[model samples]
Target: MPTTDNQGSFLNLISIRRNQVTAMDNDQELEDLELFQKNVADLFSGFLASAEEPSSAKSGVETIDSPVTARDNYIPPPPLLSISWFRNLLDAFLCCEAEFKAVLVSGRDPSQFTRPPLDRLIPDLLERSIKALDVCNAVTHGVELVRHWQKLAQIAVTALQQNPIGEGQVRRARKALTALLASTVFDVKENSNGNVHGKSAERSWSFGRRGGGGGATMNNKDPNGRNLSSFSWSVAKSWSSAKQIQAMSANLAAPRGGESTGLALPVYIISTILVFVMWALVAAIPCQERTGLATHLPLPKQLAWAQPLVSLQEKIGEEWKKKEKKGNAGLLEEVHRMEKLAQSLVEFADSFVFPMEEEKATAVAAQVKELAEICEKMEEGLGPLQQQVREVFHRIVRSRAEVLDVLDPVTKLPTPVPY
Candidate 1:
């Protein structure tokens, strides 16, 4: 058995080798990914040329500027891979990505540039690049450590996978399998053989939605019961799908009251019919009797003008039904449309929850409070006690003509009401 230091050093060398292999693999022109993967293995598995100086034989001609300098200076230091440090780097890496995503969200047209930069483009993706490098370093060290653990995890997975595997061994295998899969270094393999040390299953957990594809993660909680996000999201694997989804989301949730969308024709019809029938009935009744009507009612003179309102209302009603038929063809489509509508509301709620700007939300909350108060007042009718108002006025002035007759009744009074 190797000492921990020896294992750690070996793992570090492996990581350096892996990075070189990866760089070369990335340069592959072949369309076949398998060949690319083979290149990756070949790049690392072969013995790397040593840069250490060979002792010159007596009187041997020495070449100046050899590979020694290139090797020692360019190779990065071993990454910190302690459990605590790894976890911290993970946190920082993710936060940087989150901030980047937030900045990318234009809250307007993502493609159409607005003020400042005028686009979803952030000013300092350099920082993201830095974060990315940091993450890479963290990951590199993590992979080195993983190789060390793989030696153990493989043995565990193999023992458990054997025929008539012991129940205890199976549980151990699963526990080990989950740990291995969850590790950032090993979790993203295209091949399953590496998913577990020796287990054949290639399955892995997907995490975080990005560009478009999404993934899930295990839930963990603290002692205080405060929920912390340990999981990451990945967008759809298809780039086109991801881009489309992002665009669709951005447009649908446009900051300036989203553009009108296509609704199912039948949905429009039902919505139209409901509104028309309900409001037409309300229209026939006196404004005073209808809810929220009094405050919005036009003056008596405006009522005459509103004679067309009834016709207009009918026209609007007909248009709505027509529009519904045009947009959504049937009940099924309408229903699905409603489902998406419901999802939009959920998305809307999510908007308010995260990256919450207190100033904006507080202002909105204040406006909502005022509106709610006005609604309550309307419901209670505290300001519209017309019958009681008349009674009170009469008691105060049994005969305004009699009282005002002595006190300059002609003070431009429009003569009192005649009995």
Candidate 2:
């Protein structure tokens, strides 16, 4: 019953208030998208910065008695292939992933997840995440392999650390070092000869053939061998880390045109990060059949995270080129350090005299000290790294299931397989 002019005034005020609300929402969405991009960039920038920093100790052997300042300043080499580096990488992914999920939840219509671009992009991202789960499982097995090596190295360290390194101690250390090197050499031989496929009987920790004895263990004796089976801890012998990485990233492309909104941007960002992190794991951790692994990462410059990511990719690729044909277990810095020290110790033990000279004794002591440091690093870092990896696997599973529920309520995505 009110006049027409009064009714029009009331309607206009309501329309203005609605505009104000919509503007606030848009502003918030934009802010979140920007923060996500900045964090991804910051994560990779930190990796590059760490790589450029100087180390307190030399990459070569250094005495435990080296100046306190040097010991204090001993920053590890660039984080690319180190266990600590990988752990930090996983932490970064977990943070970014949580933010990404938040962005999806905070803005956009829930029904949009079932329409057009989101419908396709999200499902593809989820599928890549599933592939990443497989890589995580393989990497966990690789962690166990590294643990085995650490145990062998620790035996040698305990043998050599005695004040008067005795002949018996030397023999014991030699046996352990020989066993360690034999395992590496066997892997190299098997890889070089294309014998990557395991025989049904090759289900134990056998080091091909021992130097003087028949072999380290019967091919079927050690129960810890990684083989293809239904076990969550093992991967099929035919599984290739390189191939798995390739599969994850093969279809990953940046969003284009209308897909370049805040929602699609996060999907692409996460997909890129997921593939990069997996490639790094395969490169840094021991996995099956890694030869001929390509190291290219194609990212468009429009992405906020592209520059730092591209720089990191280039640095890792160069490192990979240097070690490609060496037939080493993986490109892990600790593994390389351990292998070098072990070889030198083997040579020293082989050419020893009953009563060692001062210079010879000092050199051996330095090597043992270095090996001990590597063991300690692995001991403290691997467990946490493996836990983070498992967390990543489970997180991906939950996210996929959430998305599946949105896309199709009748179908339930399975919980994370034990693997």
Q: Root-mean-square deviation of each candidate, in angstroms?
A: 38.5, 9.0
What is the lDDT, from 0 to 100, of the residue 246 in candidate 2?
Answer: 86
Worst 10 residues of 2 by lDDT: 201-210
- TM-score versus the correct structure, for each prediction: 0.17, 0.80
Worst 10 residues of 1 by lDDT: 285-294
lDDT of 1 by residue, 80-116 (tens): 2222222332333233223222322213233222222
Candidate-wise lDDT, in order: 0.29, 0.73
Residue-level lDDT of model 2, residues 1-419, one tens digit each, is: 66998999999999999999989987888898888899899988888777655453334356667787776676655456788888888988999889888888544566767665776777678668767877776677677667778888999999999989989999999999888777665463233221223221223221112143522221222367655311133344566678878888888888888677657888889899889888888887766677766767777765667788887778888888888444357788898889899999999999988799999999999999999999999999877887788788778767765665555543322322111
In terms of TM-score, how similar is model 2 to the real structure? 0.80
Q: After superposition, how far is residue 269 of candidate 1 from its true place, in Å?
A: 49
Task: Tell me the lDDT of model 2 at 78.
Answer: 42
